[model samples]
Target: MKSPSLSTTAYAGASNGESSERPPFLRMRGLCKSFGHVTALSEVDLDLREGQVVALCGDNGAGKSTLVSMLSGVIEPDDGTIEVDGQPTYMTSPLRAQELGIATVYQNLALVEQRDVAANMFLGQEPVRLGVIVDRARMVDEATRVIQRLRVGLPSVRTLVGDLSGGQRQAVAVARAMLRGSRMLLMDEPTAALGVRESRRVIELIQEVRSEGQAVVVISHNMEDVFDVADRIVVFRLGRKIADEERAGLQREDLVSLLVHGCRSEEAGER
Candidate 1:
């Protein structure tokens, strides 16, 4: 399997019909990371525009998680640079990533089972009144507003997070990230362990988020979900990026070939 040679300019001009004149909202250049002698990522470059939904697809150990970790500030790259909104930035920590308008929703969802939806939404940065106590009233009000804006159906903002269904819980997680003013969202298998109906709801949620003009990087193994929600597809293999192209002209089989053989079907025959 051969990794395609993709330059930043070539990626920007890919046939998505998006204007190449507009600069990407986020850019990663020559990102590399290694643990001891094992390289997790190598010279990977990616560009993302506002309101774009990019599906990161690959088999296990394909460096998808590693890349997401770097973007979320869970780890630092051994060599490379990250640019946000045309400014070079360092994601030193999770808090720094959030401050830089990046948020990550891991597979665990990270919601407290005992807490209500409003409480979980504003967990660490709960609103305070007069710098003395937690302002429950304001918290609920703001939570209600964000929930309504996202159109998430729930009994109430006061409903316990543990009581909500899987789909509803995923919505709450995304809503919480949005409330934090995050411009980019890194979601790890958001629809995993969900039923068909629940998965549909999550797909809708991703679409809604994209419509709100936030860039989304969805790490999903489900090909149907990728084709349904992604505007572009990025395939990683063996710690290298194998393919980066718009999703419009791509078929599921083509993506599968890339994931398995690291090349298109025709190219596979040549190899």
Candidate 2:
């Protein structure tokens, strides 16, 4: 497999003022995965900088979710190397990923409808006082702090998650990830199935997260949302990365062409 060139200006710099001289926060090389007869991903290389938002754009079955699953420890790559902080690492499980400061927020949000925001935020990792009882006060206090930090406008952390709107639920999920000390968030279709106003709220939340110096990987089919939030865009096609480019100067038509035809008109001409 050919190594991805990182010397390009597109790979340099980050919104948080991180020096390009530093290694990427996360890097994958020669990544591959398969399911019996189907190749889900092949020879894929990716880099993610700290405090940046990288959008994964592709049609269905383009291998976006496969790559995300590998990163989140939901599945392992059939072959490849994953590096964190320039050191080789294996994401063995969801717990291991969390331990490594990586978190995934799926479209469902994975929230407990019956529980309140605070309870959901601290779900499995709830604090304990004296190792005997759940620390409700600490949980609520920390939840409130995270919500404020994310600037999510919810009625209260004590409000039932089921009663919250879709955007509000997304906020709860994100706050929960932050509360768990996750430094990188892998979000899948964060704005799907929401009204225009609600989707806008989620988009703003993503920007807020980026401004706070956290890396975010957003998988979305919505081009508007992608352009609105991503610092860089990576396009996948039929189990391979066809394009990885900065969002600036990339027209929606060209991006659409890449997603549908796997190449821009100029690239097709060159071919």
Candidate 3:
């Protein structure tokens, strides 16, 4: 499978709740990372626009984790520049990325099982009283508002996170990220361990997040999930990007071929 040329103009254009003049929500150019003699990534460039779900697909060891790791500030790139809203910035730590409106929701979810939905939603940034106290009422109200807005279908904000289903728990994680005014969400295998119905709920959640005008980068191996929710697909192989195409004209088989056999020797021979 030959790489599809990415359209700069298409990516630069405005989408729902996003401004055309504003720099792309997130942009990376000439990104490179290495450890000793192993090159994890080389000259990788990527762009994420507000209100779009771009799925990053690849087999294991394809550098998908490395790319997301750098974006989440877990590790610094060996060479490259990162830009947010058109301004060059350094993401030296995960906290810095969160401060810059970038939030990462890993597979573990990092939610406290003992806490309820509202409590988990505003865990660290809980609203406080005049002096010093957690404003329980305000927290529940805000949590309810976000849940209703996203239509996540939680029974109640007070329900314990541990009691909620897998999809519901994932919803809480996503809602928590949104509470911090995050503009872009990096979700890792959100629906990995879910059943059909639960996976559907999570797929709906991803769409709802995109509808809210937040840029979303979903790292997924499930072809069904990727095709169902992604506006674009980016395929990486052997630490390099092999294809970047809009989901409209892309076939699942072609994507699978690229993943299993980079550049597809049979197809290359025919060409």
Task: Give candidate 2's error at residue 85 in angstroms.
Answer: 0.3
Error of 3 at 259 (Å): 0.2
What are the clash counts of all predictions, listed in order?
Answer: 0, 0, 1
* TM-score of every candidate relative to the true structure: 0.92, 0.92, 0.89
What is the Å distance of residue 113 in model 2 from its true position? 1.0
- What TM value does model 2 have? 0.92
RMSD per model, one decimal? 5.7, 5.8, 5.1
| Model 3 accuracy (lDDT, Cα) | 0.84
Candidate 2 lDDT, 100-193, residue by residue in tens: 8998998888999999999999888989989879999998899999999888998899999999998899889988887778889999999887
List pairs with backbone clashes in candidate 2. Answer: none
Candidate 3 residue lDDT tens string, 17-91: 324566678889999999889888998998888888889999998989899998889999999999998899899
Give the lowest summed-lDDT range of ten residues in model 2. 1-10
